[model samples]
Target: MIEPETVIICLRAAMLGAGAVCFGAGSAALLLAPPQVASVLRAYLQPVLRGAAGVLAVAALVSLAVQTADASEDWSQAISPSALFMFATTTHAGRTSSARALLAVVSALCILLARGNRIALLRLGSLTAGLFLASFAFSGHAAMHDEPTRTLQEANHIAHVLSGTFWTGALVALFCAAIILLRRPSGDQVEGAELMLRRFSPAGVTAVVIVGLTGALNTWLILGRAPLDRGSIYQLLLAAKIAAVAVMLGLALANRFYFLPRATRPAALVASIAIECALGALVIALVAVFGTLEPV
Candidate 1:
């Protein structure tokens, strides 16, 4: 017997995780252009970025549907094969279910509108990233609660999430893009692949800084104090998240100053990004659980 609250909470957790992936990957794709082009990045880079964003977007919408089903009694009871086949939904459907579903459809349409414009697709993907990032405010412990400075806290929370999403999502997608671009022996393409890694490395470093600073500011507002004073589950999660992110940074630094300058093949780039993705997924899992916990 999954209660509506429990179901909704679970969906919100998955949504936060998936949304982080979307925002991170989409931003990486968008920013890769100017710098990577000069460095002679592989041809398949843009398409892989778009594909990763598309996949992450779909995951987010699926989570939204789960929440919708839980919120709506009609949707909840008959949601198996029959209702889905009939496209039936519940009357108690949440406002966010409707809005997020609409956003998912719109974001999908936006991707189709891009067609084959690598540059446009890259930028458009980043904009869709913005949509999922906003989903955080409408759900979770933050939604519909009363407080002395709720508005200010929500605003700060949004910034914290957006900045972290862009930073984290971009790194995850960049790794995927690397894998797609690096497949097979790249005897001729080695130079371009290496160039892409080198160019994007600095940007990754910068995004880490932004994620940390914005996240710290957001926490100060949300907790009404620094990490030491805040005693909520969310605060504890924040501490863990900071530590995980620190480890991720160490990995990125290793990739940058150690392997990248001389990484001579598409396979090496692909493998390196794969390792990064594994680490990133671990961080996102923490974020998923974090988003579900109470702030106070």
Candidate 2:
């Protein structure tokens, strides 16, 4: 028989993955385009986000199946394997919707930014993201109570999640944009692309800083400021997530300092984009770990 703890762990992982993917994709898609074009791009998100959503959807359904079976029967053997799949599927769907909502609004603001009004887009996106993320924490089991500590932790956690998503999404969008410019080689678009790239760099830097601040805040609230002689699992997980993020930042810095400015070779650019995507996937997976880990 499958262990209850195993099931719980997997369900949490699925939740984290769905949340991160949805939010990240939303931010990146919106950031990649100008206000108007971003609106249109919303309709054409890449299959990775969709596919992940689908998989998580199935997983949620599967979880529901197991829970239902257990509830009706022994509360142990209630949900069959198939039912568990359904649980994961449905849960993933909700998570994906939350993310897509955030992304959609960002895309809407894309049009405004495209018209050379980025401050407007940032303000709009940030405001929208806050509302959506609040909806996010309460949407699940975490909303069961309204205790003060939990309320604060929940808010901080939500901020951490949103900031991470924004950071990763922007990176993905920029990476994709880089690939497009390298392959297409259009003189008319070159200047525009270059300007966008420059704009993206500072944005990336900002995201990294925000990520650090939010993450530190989350840690302080979640784990008290007691020094540990050795690393616990949460610490280990946080370290892994942070390392992954640092590597990604390094790559971005390399691109900005070395490749992007020089208009590096197409081969080099493609390589960097692929690396960015791979690292992003790693970051997403690591984020899943962060969610599951205990604060203490």
Candidate 3:
């Protein structure tokens, strides 16, 4: 049987991964697509965001409970209101978890309102989602370093995650949009996809660069000249993540320069995008594993 701590770790990772996809896809739709297109896309995407937010809320609660249990060594105390309040107010991890829960609640509410067909609500939802994404940097390894380095690493990690999500989430949104278009094939759908592809190409390139630079910075900060052959689980996971990202970049390049330019079959493009999204999820899962492992 898996230990409760292990379960909490998995929950944290899943929460983060789901939150990234939710926040990234929603923000990308708002930023990259026209209002009409974005609205339509949001109708499909908001439900996903709401579901992810719910998961995040539950995970945060469970994680906190686990931490309290471990710290106090008593399940009954862990579940007590007084204990929960004490943990939330006293510990950094607890505070971060509380913040995450609040953000998830706000994000979910905004997403629901955004679905009400109000422009103001949509914009608010998008901004809230971005904030939700940024919250992840407040905890984890990024928050472990001392003083100046801690601040710098946290900022870099935020940028790295936001940029990575933009790329991955945009791909997912595009894939969903593409599927809708394929089914109907209206002139507007074709034009909208084309426009979004063109707009996102430049942004995607910039995001890739940021992800690379920040990823290297993070690795340096965490590993700090250590050799991977030390057989550390964290290092092994990091290496796997790097390789997965490299493959994603290759696929993105193929889509941009080759398949995209040639107007590859819609089915083919969709397949490629789906594959990229799958790989992106794998990277997120690895990141979750990395967060749980101790770096050396």
Best model per TM-score: 3
Tens-digit lDDT string for candidate 2 (174-199): 55556656765455455545555676
Tens-digit lDDT track for model 3 on 204-287? 899999999998998888778533654787888888888888999998887777766655366766777789888888888888
Model 2 / residue 224 / CA error / Å: 1.3
lDDT of 3 at 292: 68
Backbone clash pairs in model 3 (N, Cα, C under 3 Å; residues 3+ apart or in different chains), count: 0
Candidate 1, position 60, lDDT: 50
lDDT tens digits by residue: candidate 1, 133-231: 676665554454467566655666676677666666666655644554556344444444455556676777676776777677666655667655355
> Cα miss at 99, model 1 (Å)?
2.5
Tell me each candidate's TM-score: 0.71, 0.66, 0.91
1 or 3, which is superior by lDDT?
3
Among the numbered candidates, top lDDT falls to 3
- When sorted by lDDT, best at the front, the candidate numbers are 3, 1, 2
For model 3, the superposed segments whose C-alpha errors exceed 4 Å read none
Q: Identify the superior model by lDDT, candidate 2 or candidate 3.
A: 3
